[model samples]
Target: MHLPIDLVMKIYYMILAVIGVPVNLVAIVILSRGKCGLSTCTTRYLVAMAAADLLVIITEVILRWINLYYFPVSFLDITPVCSVIAVLKRAATDCSVWFTVTFTFDRFVSICWQKLKTKYCTGRTAAVVLATSCILLSSKNIPHYFVFEPWVIIDNVPWGCATIPAYVTEPGWVGFDWFGTVLTPLLPFAAILLLNTLTVRHILVASRVRKRLRGESKGENGSDPEMESRRKSVILLFTISGSFILLWLVYVVHFLYYSIAGINPDYYKDSISTFAQVGSILQNLSSCTNTFIYGVTQSKFREQLKSAVKYPVSSIIQLIKKKQNN
Candidate 1:
C-alpha cells in the first residue's frame, strides 16, 4: 500500500527540487528585467520574492540531494548545518511572505485605489517594504537559535540524525505551540484574503466599466464581447492567489492539529510527513508560480520571459562570432 515515509519524503522533495530550479530561475530573470509592466515600486518586491524563492529552491535541492544521496537515514551531525538549513528555511519563507504580502498591498494601492501611482510608492519604497518584512520575520524566528542548541552528547552518539528534542527549552516557552504556528500565520492569511479580495473586486469593476464604455460607443445593447475575455483573465489570476491560500491553510490545519490537540504525532506520522512535504513544496511553488500567473493572465510577463530567455543565448552566439572574426 503506502510507500515508506522516508522514501516518499525523499522522492517528493527531490522531484520538487528538480522542478523548482528552472521555474524559479525564469521568475528571477523576468522579475529582474522589470519588463512585466511592473511599476518601479512593485518590481523590487517581487524580485526579492523571486530571489528568495531561488535561494529556497537551492536549499531544497541541497537538503533533498543530501537526503537521497549523501545520508538517507542519518549522517547530518553538524548542528550548524541543521541550524543553518533551518534558519534559511525560516528566512526564505519569512522574506517570501513579506514580499508576497507587500506585493498584495502594492496591487491594492496601485490598481484598486489608484492613488499610490503619484505618492510614496517607488522602487525605493518596495525595497524598504522588503527590508522591513525581513527584519520583523527574523526577529520572530530569533528564539529558535538560542533554544535549539546542540547537545554535544547527542551528536557524539550514533542515533541516526541529531534530533531536535522536545521540552528542553524554557518552561514558559516549552509548550506554547498554539501561539506559534496556527495563530501567527493566520493573521497573514486574513490579510491576504482581504487584500486579494479587494484587488479582484476592483479588477472586475474596471472590466465592467470598460465594457460599459465599449457598448455605449458601439451602440450595442447588453454587454461588450471583450468582457468575457477580461473575466477569464481575472479568474485565472484569482486562482493563483487562491492557490497560495489553500496550501497555507492545509499547513496551518495540520500544524494546529498537532500543536493544539496534542495528538500522538506517531499515529498520524505517515500522513503528517506526507502532507508536510506536499505543502512545503506547494508553498514554494507560489513563489515561482507568480511568474506563470503573470505570464498567462497578463501577456506582457509572458512575452518578456520569452524574450529574456532567447536574447541572452543570441548575445552569446553573436559574441562568439565577433571573437572569431577578430
Candidate 2:
C-alpha cells in the first residue's frame, strides 16, 4: 500500500531518529573518555556536538514521529509541552551546528595560529566557551517557547506547533528568518571556509618545511606524529564541514532569496516545499554521519568503541538467544 508523502516523511524522520541517536551516543561516549589523549579542547567541543545531536534526535526527531503518528493522543498537542519541545529542538539544533563551527575554529587556531593555542585553547577555556554558547543560544530560543502555540484542525484537539497567528504576519518573522538562515548559518560558513583554506595552505607549507628539516637533520623524529595527527584532524574536519555545507546550503539559499527578494513564502509552497523537505532530511541525516566519520578517521575511537560495546552487546545477544529458545 502506498502512503502519503506526509507519512513517508514521518517514517523517514523515525528512521533517522533510530539510527542517529545511538550513533551520536557512541560518539559522546568515545569523545568523553579521552581515549586518544587528543587536545581536551577538541574533546570538549566534539563531546558537546555529539550530545547536542543526540538531544536533537530525541527531542526533535523522535518526538516529531510520535506527534505525526499519535495525533491528539500525543503530548505534542498540548500547548506547554509543544512549546517546550520546539524550544528544545531549536536549541539542540543550534548547539549541534554551532559547536561544529567551534570545533573547526579550535582546530584552525591549533594549526594556523600555533602561538595562540598555548594561551587560548585550553580545556577550561573550551568549557567556558561551550557553556556560554549554550546559555546564549538557549536564551535566544526562549522567545520561541512563547511564540509557538498549539493550533487545532478538523475538530481535533490540536495539530502541531506554530507561531501564534499574529506573529506570523509580523515584520519580526522576516528578521527571524534572516537571523536563522543568514546570521546563524552563513557567518559560520564563511568562517569555516576562510579558516580551512588558510589551514590547508599552512599544512602544505609546513609539510615542505618538515621534509627539508628531516633531510638536513637525518635522524630526527620520523615524520612528526604530531603533525600527522593534525593533518588527520584537518581532513576529518574538512569532511564534516563539507557535509554540513552541502546539506544546508540549499535551504540557506532559498531562505535568503525569499527573505531578501521580498518573495512571499506561501507563493512557493507548492514548488519549493519538496526541495525544502529534502534539505531538512539531509540535515537530519548529517547528524548520523559524524560518528561514522570518527570511526573511519581514528583508530583510537574504534578501539574505545569496541571496548565500550563488546561486553554488553554479546550479553544482550545471549539473552536474546535464551529468550528465543524458551
Candidate 3:
C-alpha cells in the first residue's frame, strides 16, 4: 500500500527530530572537550555548527513541523509567539550555513596561505567570527517577524501566524526576501565552490613542489610529514564542504526555478510541488548530516563518539551491580 506523501513527510520529520537532536548534542559535547585531535579553532567552528544544527531541529522540526502536524493548538501557535519562532528558525538556519562557509574559509587559509593562517586560524579569531556572524544574521532576521500577521483573531488574541500579503507584493518585503535568499545558500554556495577550487589548485601545485624537494619525485623514498598532514586537512575540508553542496543542491535548484519563473510555490503543479517538498526535506536533512560526516572523515571523532556512547551504559551497569550487592 502506498502511503500518502503528507503522511510520509510527517514520519520522516518525526524521525529526523528524534535522531537529529541527540546526535548533534553528542557531537557538540564530544567536539567541545578538545579530545578529537582537531585544532582548537576547528573545534570551535564544529561545536558552533553542531549547536546551530541542534537549534534548527528544535525550532524547525520539533516546534514547526511536529507542532503543525500533531499539536495544532498550543501557545506556540499564537501569532506573536510563532512569529518569534519563525525569526529564530531563519536565524539558526542562516548561522548554520554561514558557519560552514567560515569554517571552509578558515581551512582554506590554513592550507593555502601560511602567512595568514597564523592570525586568521586562531581560536580567538574563530570565536570572534562566529559571534559576529551570529549577531549579524540574527539581526537580519528581525524583519521577518514583522512580515507575519495573525492567521486568525479569536476573542482578543491572534491565534496563528500568516504571512502578510504585502510580503509578496510590496517592493520592500520582496527586496528583503531576495536579499535573504542571496545572503544564505546562494552566496554561501558560490563561496564554498570557489574556495574549494582554489584550495585544490594550491594543494596540487604544493604537493608536486614538495615531492620534488623531498626527492620523492626522483624515487628517493621518504615520508613527507607536511604532505601527510595536508592530506588529512584536505580530506576533512572537502568532505564537509562537499556534503554541504550535495545536500543543498536540490533546494538551491528549486529556489532558482521558482524565483526565475516568478511562480508562487503554492500554485505549483503536482510534480513541481513534490520537487519543492523534496528540496525542503533534503535541506533539513543537511542539518543532521555533519555529525555523521565527522565520524566518517576523522578517526578520532569516531573514537570519541564510541567513548561517549559507552560511558552512560557503563555507568548504568556499574550502578546496577552496586545496588544488587548492597
Candidate 4:
C-alpha cells in the first residue's frame, strides 16, 4: 500500500538525521587528521564543509524538523528560541552551500592558475576565507530573527515563532527575502557551474599541450604524472560540485516558479505541494552526500573510512584476547 506523503517525509527526515549526523562527524574527524592524502588547504576546506554540513543536520533536520514532528512543544518552540534557531539554520545552510562554492573555486584555481594557486591555496588563506565566509554569512542571517513574531502568547510569554504577516508584503522584509534567496543557492549554482566550466576548458587545452611536449603527439605514449594528478583532482571536484548542482536543481526550479508566480507555498495545491516537499527533501539530502562523494572519489578517504569502521571491532577483539590471557 502507498503511504501518505507526509508520513513518507517524516520517515525520510528521521532516517536523514540518523545518517547525516554521524556521517558528517566521521568525515570531519577523518579529514581534520590530515592523513587523507589531501593537501593542508584542501583538508581545511573539506573539514569546514563537513562541520557546516553537521550544523545543517543539527539545526535544520534535527532541531527544526524532528522537534516539529516529534516533540511539538518544547523550549525550542519558544518565540525567541525558535527565532535564534531559524537564524542558525539559515546561516548553516548558507555556509554549507558557499563552502562548496569556495572549495570549487579553490580547486579551479589550483588546476587552471598555477602561479596564483601557490599564493591563494595555502592553508592560512583557506582558513581566512572560511572564517570570513562564516562571519559574513552568519551576520547575513541576523535579520531573520526580527522577521518572526509569537505564534501565540501564553501568560505573557511568546510560545512559538511565526513569520509576521507583513513579512510577505512589507518592503524591507520582501527585499531581504529576495536578497537572501539570490545570495545562496542562486549565486552558488551559477558560480560552481562557471568555475567548473572554466576548469574543464583549461584542463583540455593544457592536456593537449602537455602531451605534445611529452612527445606523446608523435608516437610515444608515456605516463604523465601531472596529468594523472590533475585527473584525480578533477574527478573529486566534479563529483562534489555535480552532486550539489543536481540535488539543488529541483529546489531552484521550485523557487523560480513560486517567486515568479507570486504564490505562497502554504497555499499550494496537493500536487504542487508534493513537488515543493520533494524539493525540500532533495535539498536536505544534499547535506548527506559529500561524505559519500569523498569516499567514492578519493581513495585515501575510503581508506580512512575503512580504518575508522574497523577500529571498534579491532578494539573489541583485542579486549577479548587480553581477557583470555589474563
Candidate 5:
C-alpha cells in the first residue's frame, strides 16, 4: 500500500530526526552561549540556521508522522490542522533552503572580499538577512494557504488530504506552482552555485599563494589542510543541494509537461511521484548531514561534540566511583 511504504519511511525519518533535533539544539545552545555581539556574523548565522532546521525537523516531520498514521485528515478538524501543517512544512523546507543560501553567501563574502569580513558580516546584519529571507518565503507561501482546501476522497482505503486540485483554471495557480517548484529552487540554487564555484576557486588560489609564501613545496594542489577542507565543504554542499534541485526539477518538468503539452506519461506518474515524495523526505533527512559535516570540517564543532560525548562518560564513571565509596 502507499501508506505502508510511507509508514516505513516515516519510521526511518523519525529515527534520524530524533538525532538531528537534539544535536541542533545543542549547536544552538553553544552558539548562543558565545559572546556574539555584532562582530560574530557568520558564526551566528550558521548556528541560527542550525536551530531553524532543528525546529523544522521536529514540527514538520514529527507532526507529519502523527497525521499520517495516527489521525488521517478526514477524521479530524481539517482546516486548522492542514493550515498549521502547511505553515510548518513550508517554513521548515523554505528555512532549510534559504538558510543554506545565507550560509553560502556568508562564506562567499568572507572569501571573495576580505573587507566584508570586517564590514558587512556583523551579527546585526546577519540577523537582518535572516529576517528578510523569512519574510520573503512566508509571503511566497501565502498563496498555498489561500488556495488549498480539504480534499475529500471517496473509496480510498483511508481518507487522505492533499492540496486541492491545483490543476484547475484560475488566474495564477499554475504560476504559483511553478514558482514554488522551480522559480524559488532555481533562483537560489543558481545563486548558490555561482557563489560556491567562485569561493572554491578563490580558496584554491589563496592556498597556493600561502604555500608559496611559506616555501612549503611538499604537498599536492588541494592537499593544504584549510584549502582541502573548504573544498570538501563546497563539494558537500553542492552534492547535497544538487540532489535537491534535481529531484524538484523532475516535478517541475512533469508539471510543465502536463500543463503545456497535456502529456502524462504513466512512467513519470508512478515513478516520479514516489521519487518526488520519498526523495524529498530523504533529502530533508539529509539536512542533518550538515551537523555531521560541521563535526568533520569545523574543528570547533568537533571538539565541542567530543567533549559533550565524553562528559556523559565521565559523569557515569564518577557516579559509579561515588557509589563504591559509599
Candidate 6:
C-alpha cells in the first residue's frame, strides 16, 4: 500500500520531535554550561538558535502533525489555540532563520575585523543582537495573529483543526508574502553567503601570515591558540551555513515562484506539495545536525560532553556499588 502524504508528514514530524528536540536541548545545555563564558558571543548565539529551533519543532512540526493526523475533527472548538500555534510557529521560524544570519555575521565580524571585534563582538553584544532580532521578528509576525482564523464548515465532520489564513484573497496578501519570504529566508541566505565568503578569505590570509611568522620564528612547535580557535569556529560556521542553504534553497525557489508566477492555484499544488514536503523535512533536519557538527569539529566540546555524561554515570555506579556492599 502506498503511504498517504499526510501519514508521511506525520512520520516526518514525529522524527523531528524525537530527534531535533533532544539534540537541540543537549546543544543548548552543553554550549551554556561549558567553559565558554556567558559573554562568549558564539556560545550565546548558538544557544539562542537551539532554543528557536526547539520552538519550531514543537509548534510548526509536531503540533501541525498532530492537528492533521490525530485530532482532525474537534480541535477547532478552541479557535484561539489554533491561532496561537500558527503565530508561534511563524514567529519561531522567523527567529530561527534570522538567527543563523545573525550568528554568521557575528563570526564574520570577529574574523574579518579584528580591531572592532573586541569592542563589538562580545557576549553582551551577541545578547543585544539576538534580543533585537527576536523583538523585531516577533513584532513583524503579529499580523499573523489576525490573519490566522479557525473555521468549522459543518457539524459532526471531523475535518481536523487548523488556523487557515483568512485574508489570502486580499490584495495586500501578495505584498505581505513577498515581504515575509524575503525578510525571513531569502535575505538571510544571501547575507550568510556573502559574509561566509568574506570570512573565509580573511581566514586564508591570516593563515598565510601565521605561516610566515612561524617560518621567521624558526622553532615553534604549536600554532597561535587564538587563531586556532578562530579556525575551529569558522569550520563550524561553514557546516551550519552550508546545511541551511542546501536544505532551504529549493523551498525558497518554489516559494518565490508561487508568490510571483500567479499560476493557476489548482494546477501545481500536487507537484508543489511533494517538493514542499521534502524541503520542509530537509530544513528541519538541519536543526538536528548542529550538535553533531560541534562534537565533531570542536575537541573542547567533546571533552566537556564526555565529562558531563561520565560524571552522572560514575555517580550512579558508585551509588549502586555502595548499596551492594552494604
Query: lDDT: which candidate is best?
Result: 4
- Candidates in order have lDDT scores of 0.64, 0.79, 0.91, 0.92, 0.65, 0.79
The predicted structure with the larger TM-score, 1 or 2, is 2
List model 4 lDDT by residue over 243-281, tens digit each.
999998898889888777766565689999999989889
- 1-326, model 2: which lDDT tens digit per residue? 98766777877887787789889988987798898657798899888988988988887678765466655366566767888888888888888888888888888888888899898799999999999999998888887777765666546555566666545457886567567655557887898798889889999898878877778346555657867788788878898788878877876776666565565544456557766666677777777888988888888888888888897998999999999999
lDDT tens digits, residue span 1-326, model 1: 98876666567566666766777787777777777765677668767877877776776555634454557555454556655666666667767665666776776676666565567567887777788878877667665544345545463653222324453233455454444453346666787789878877877678768867767646776645545654544454365557668767767776766565555443456667678656665665565666666666767777887887799899999999999999
Model with the higher lDDT, candidate 3 or 4: 4
What is every candidate's alpha-carbon RMSD to the true fold? 4.5, 4.1, 1.5, 1.2, 5.1, 3.2
Give the TM-score comparing model 6 with the true structure, all chains together.
Answer: 0.88
TM-score of each: 0.77, 0.85, 0.95, 0.97, 0.77, 0.88
**True-vs-predicted CA distance for residue 323, candidate 1, Å:** 9.4
- Candidate 5 per-residue C-alpha lDDT over 1-326 given as tens digits, one digit per residue, 9 for 90 to 100: 35666667667776766787887877776556563221277667767678767866776666665455555554433655666667767766787778778877876786678877777777888888888988888677766666555455456432334555543444377666657756456676688778878887887788778888766766534346766556655654565455556545654555565557533333246655675566556555645666665665556666777777899899999999999999
The sequence of per-residue lDDT tens digits that candidate 6 reaches over residues 189-275 is 889999998998888888878877778446556758878778778888898889889988887877877666655333467778777
lDDT of 5: 0.65
lDDT of 1: 0.64
**Model 2 lDDT, full chain set:** 0.79
Give the Å error, residue 261, model 3.
3.4
Deviating ranges (above 4 Å) for candidate 3? 266-269, 324-326
lDDT of 6 at 66: 57
- Measured on C-alpha atoms, candidate 4 has an lDDT of 0.92
Off by over 4 Å in 1: 1-5, 72-76, 147-171, 174-179, 182-184, 203-239, 263-268, 312-326
What is the C-alpha RMSD, rounded to one decimal, of candidate 2?
Answer: 4.1
